[model samples]
Target chain A: MTAPAAPQTAPSPAAAPAGAPAVIRAIHLSKVYELGAQQVRALDDVSLEIGKGEYVAIMGPSGSGKSTLMNVLGCLDVPSSGEYWLRGQEVSKLSEDELAEIRNREIGFVFQTFHLLARQTALRNVELPLVYGAVRADERRARALELLRQVGLEKRADHKPNELSGGERQRVAIARALVNRPALLLADEPTGNLDSRTGKEILELLDRLHGEGHTILLVTHDPEVGRRAARTVRVRDGRIESDAPNR
Target chain B: MIALLEGVRIALQAIWGQKLRSALTLLCVIIAILSIIAVVSVLDGMDLYVREEVAGAGANVFTLRRVDELKVLTDLQVFLDSLGNPRITLADWKALRAEMTLAEFVDPLRSRSGDLQAVRDGRSIRNVDLQGRGAEYPGIEDLDLERGRHLTQADIDQRREVLVIGAQVAETLFPGVDPLGQKVRLSGRHYEVVGVFARRSNVLGQDRNIFAILPLSALFAQFGSFRSISVQVKAKSLGDFAAALDEARTIMRVRHGLRPQDPDDFNLTTAEQFLTLWEKISSGIFATLIGVVSITLVVGGIIIMNVMLVSVTERTREVGLRKALGARRGMILFQFLVESVTLTSVGGVVGIVLGFAAAFLIGAFSPLPYSVKPWSIVSALVIVFAVGVFFGLYPASRAARLQPVEALRRE
Candidate 1:
């Protein structure tokens, strides 16, 4: 299935039922931390709606709770005292197993570190999600090879992650993220470990994916990266400072 | 379930990464199974030899001796009481042989208590077992002559000073030169060698080739009177053996006037009894072997658990990466369990190979034949697998319990 599979506009007024969901909707979401005696708020009273086929960047400096919002939005973590609805289902009350099922089926995560299993080849690493998805070995191998070809790494499909350059590793991670054809591509600092020359190449890949009607959420501390998105949400001090559409 | 194959692949890779440590960990388990199998094989071989060779070959042949005790010595009271009881003698043998209608042959055999020596022209062999036998003894005991002729009934009727030595005694006393008709002195009495026995069977690791046999009449004439001796009785066939044994027992009991309530003072030893006694002894040895081996497995398992825990801690980041890639906790747990089972099962296979080699060595160099009990091998596999599962649980679960975020951040 492709992104915007059941596209719903952001906060439609009286045109749709209350039960209809956008791609992602968070209502008064909050996350509190308990470090010894201190209760630091990671997210507080944040409400947001992300529709289908939207490239949204959550930009913030360190400790500005952008990571927290990304985790909550990707279903890696649950928010405190709030409701999170993804693909028309409330997930705040879901158990860990249910949340894991949601993550595997609905969200594709791209990490800054690449997180490729070091011992496995690029093809094997790409096929990991399909393995957990109960796909047969022959089909998984074929699909993983296809994904590698899309990222222009067909020749390097048998190479381990360490054998590849930083940009190549990021591309492999992107291929892995899209292998499951998840509705939302959630990338957390997809180019944080790359140089500017390599980082721009990764951003170009993201731009092409978005052009093909993929919903992308890029979280970064760099403003240059944030500006590439059509919509940017700037977070500071555990709250959103700006939510605006860019040209 | 499909991921089990992948789990095995991962486990193999992990073991390959630490080859030396894996070998060392397997050493304890290897040695445990090796020694257990080797020891059990030896005991099993002994039981085989006891049944096949030492039980006197044929089921129709049985011995009537003084004591029923097979391996364990009789208690002091039983021994003292047996000493008071009448010794099995020539008259008792004759009387028992006369009353048996189903009997084929009865041979009276008298053995000297201490060691006997034979000397010929300054060459002497000490520790030669001396037994005086009737002419029927050769047929009943199946002693094949390698040289010369057996003592005829005339040798016993005339009370001739004729002797038959074993092949080894002939080799020791009269090497190279003809031992037939050679005179050998025993206890200051000279006797002409009439026959030599063939070296065929090895019994209880003792040299049966060092036997010295003489006529019972000559033995009585030289040693005053026959006192303590055993009589071997052979039945006509397997079908009538029970009736033959009952007739002998009845004649003997009537001769001794044994009351119904009183147990027979004489002991009856059948080939079956000897085999059962061996089984009892070997099973005890097997039990002891299992006890010693289980200790090794316990110690080995504890070491494996410690090593696995360290491995889990070392590979925490890899676990986090797998979990993030959609692996469930059960998958992670199964992966580690497979690793340990692979380690021990590999050890078990190696141990069995080494154990068979050891048994072969014993068979090649020693009198004991290499006998491997099938159950011992099955138990070794079952035991090693159990140790792996039992010891690997804590570490595997610890690895599975690690949170993806926490593990990803670990060094």
Candidate 2:
């Protein structure tokens, strides 16, 4: 299978204006995993470009390269080979510290599992990113409350993850991801753990956020979810099958 | 500062969440620290008391004997060689008293066995150390008299049957009535209780209130041979104390010795010499106790480290989330370190207060000299804090080095 084509769109506002064509540009990105001497190619030379303010959905079957690609894009893993530039900074070759700084300043992640700190209140969970960014206490608290209010969790701000419903917890997670006002919001099956009605609510919230000009990348196996994005990319057997604008 | 405060808030929240486990862990640290502080404070207090008592008794007076006088060296050979056949007799005292100009008083002491019965309203006391000395004994030693007259020259010269009873003896024999001029039977001999001596103060271990004194000549006639004699002297000034000691030594050597090469006999002890010996013994005991206490503190520090390691492991997912959000490894390290240190420091403060309470209780009820030094409290705090930092480093580093992916995977 050949690598996928680069994402096509105009430059995003969050991206640097210093001659950068896209917010994220991946060329021949590949990741290989060795499990007990069994070699598995998770991502086979995937190349893609995602412009600023673009809402893209990545869909694939089980064992497809979507998760690996997401890991690479989020700077949580280094590609086995190839160049990946985040906002014109070559993230593939960045040091661990540099990668951490970029992760703090450029990307926000929403996991399939709400992943809120069980011991912390919703407000504290949202403040986690600002803590990493070394934001002052007064500013961190004020901004965290603002994000909680944005997610309509102001009344439930003091409740812990276990005290909240799946939908509310996910909303708190979303609030946490957007607290630092990151360049991109990367959501991996954000609604996977919720009921259908709660999942619809989450999708509606993401749809609202995208409409409000937030750059979003959604990874899912569901076609209905994919159709909501501005563009959809399909992957199979460690390669992209198609990349096109959604109807 | 904000980061530190955030770290503190997070740590408190985590500890509050696991209340039982955290309290149990803190209990271990508190016991360890308490043990150390208690032992050190008591020892420090005892040392101070010993020094003060010894110094008050005398610090400039040095005893001189034909042999080494301070009891620092105690061998059979030294003792035998030091105490030769030449005893400090009455004639020797007379010669030394006349020859030594710096000698304040040369009082020859002799012990006698005499059963005294002071019949007041029918009760009598027994078994007192009946001591006898010359007329100069009370003046040279500065003995305190509670009532009645001391031994006079006429009493010694005329060999009068008179006596002075210590406070304990007076209380026992006389009860409510005064014992002065009352006749006491001693070794089947009758002697009048001429005076009641005051109770000795600030003395350790022995009761000075169970004794009686008589004139030296009278005691010899009544009982007989004495083995030892102590010569008490007060120098003209502090600067002349050494010179007076030297003069007394020369006179004693001349009166007791045969040839120029022969060593004299007798052990002379001054208040200063006794004080030094007491300090040496007390310091050795204090050092040994401090060593054992320090071991407990070390064990406590190790327990803190172990608990912190467990905490770091339990919070792996939380750490991962923070890291993914943008926390640097240094921030992670700092947060964990602060938590561990805060735990130990709190335990230390509690331990110190507990130590002071223990010391106070001991001082109130027991004769053991217990005083808490301010520096000791400060030292305890500093040492415990250092222990927290030392033990916390490994676990904190482990947390800081955790990979976001691996940590999240653990969850």
Candidate 3:
């Protein structure tokens, strides 16, 4: 394990005020995937908006189009038709390169599988986003270190995914997602692979990050994870069912 | 770029994770490059050895003979035709020497009197390559004497029983005593030792030194008339070699009374002919080598492409994750190329090292002075990289073109 590095001086993009401009706005968006015989509408006629300081949970059971919605929102996929705006940009119409840039600069994702590169250590995993961002090596190291410290995994910076516990690996994943200081932290089933107690610990960490004013879009089927968010949007059979405040 | 460094890192990790697969993919390249480097190294060494040997004797020197060796190799008709041609006799050598104007020296020589054995005080040197030559033979060849002197014109004309022994012959005949002014028996006849030629380079073979020289008069007197005699001719200057060859050919033709339509009965070949013969032989070998090695490399490349396709398929989720994390298609493509290239480049390096070692071992045990050319090494490396990129293209593009959402959704 390498020595714990000094923290980054660049502040995280987590200081949005309430009622700030909406960072994600979708208007009647749809996504269709063609199978051999059937046309699978993974997302259909969904309209939604997420503000800069909002903590929103998108919930749906398996094959409910919730994953597709998260993918589209994270700039990993574009809608088949309809306008989708991310941070005032029409993301639905963006080219692959532009979408990649948006994903690098504006969206940070934590996947259900942890998605940490198996060969890389915790520090290198966190440094990945900055590498895509073309950040200098020294700054990448410092920022990844700061994110690791923030996630309380500073001492485990050099530990590979296999060496870390499930919850600890998720923490490292969280640090990796935050390394670029992206405006949107999009997590897909952040606790799907963790035990109930570890799941709660991950939720508490998300809660603390939300308290710091970071915009979060959590995708999960679990009601417990949804309840932790300020708002919940439920989807079923490729269409939005309800959008309501958690209170 | 950071992308390149990261790509290399990813490739190395991929290779480490699947060593057996990578080694299997690299097998063809290794074998192909190894054989090429080894053969080319030995061949190149031999080439240098021949060229140096020829150049030492002087490139402008040529032998006038009854049959050309290259003609025997390249033409079936010439082989039959040359066999019927008249043996160039002492009379012909005398005529050419008297008539030639451009030649600096025209020295007649005769060999293959392999039956002759030299003895001094009952210490005989057997298996000697005894050559009978005119006095000017020393001028046309690189014969440097260590003691006494070459047989002079007076010695050749007066038919003195004078002999110039090879270093090997002198060593065997005179052991501890100076060979100069000593008497040796040749074909049961006594002859005075005129000179001892310097030890020749043993690069080709040590057997080159086991020879003795006798004046044509003395040899003819002792061994009777020879079958055919060859004359060594040297140009006045290196630049006048063509002119000298033309003059000699024209003189010989006029003397033989040959018509312009008829091919000359005598063969004219220069030291360069030896080098050219080697080149012809090696080029045939080289072409066949290229054919086999290229097929192996191409087949290896195809296998690598197949393996890369499998690798890309296996890493769909990882690709998707990287794409979602902001890796562009170009980055994905470049990373895979780096992987393929690293695999083959590593093989190329190993093969080259093995080739050098093999060449060294072969040269050590044999008379071959094996050496590797720098450009062959460079070209082999370039070939490795080129093959990798060419073969890696399809698989890398396949990985690059994947939609992140689709890829991420793969179970």
Native-to-model Cα distance after best TM-score fit, residue A202 in candidate 3, in Å: 1.5
Q: Report the lDDT tens digits of candidate 2 across residue range B115-227.
A: 56754454666668887777877645546899998998898888888988899888888877888989888777788889998987433445768889887777777766555
**Is 1 or 3 the stronger prediction by lDDT?**
3
- How far off is each candidate at the interface, as Cα RMSD in Å? 1.7, 1.6, 0.9
Ranking by TM-score: 1, 2, 3
Top of the candidates by lDDT: 3
| Tens-digit lDDT track of model 3 for B320-360 | 88898899899999989988888788888888888788889
Residue clash pairs of candidate 1: none
Which regions of candidate 3 are displaced past 4 Å?
A1-21, B12-35, B116-127, B158-162, B169-194, B203-206, B221-223, B259-262, B273-278, B290-315, B346-365, B409-411
lDDT of each: 0.82, 0.79, 0.85
> Chain B TM-score of all predictions, in order?
0.93, 0.86, 0.85
Query: Which residue pairs collide, candidate 2?
Result: A7-A49, A12-A52, B115-B186, B115-B187
- Residue B104 miss distance in model 3 (angstroms): 3.2
TM-scores of the models, in the order given = 0.89, 0.87, 0.86
DockQ of each: 0.41, 0.59, 0.58
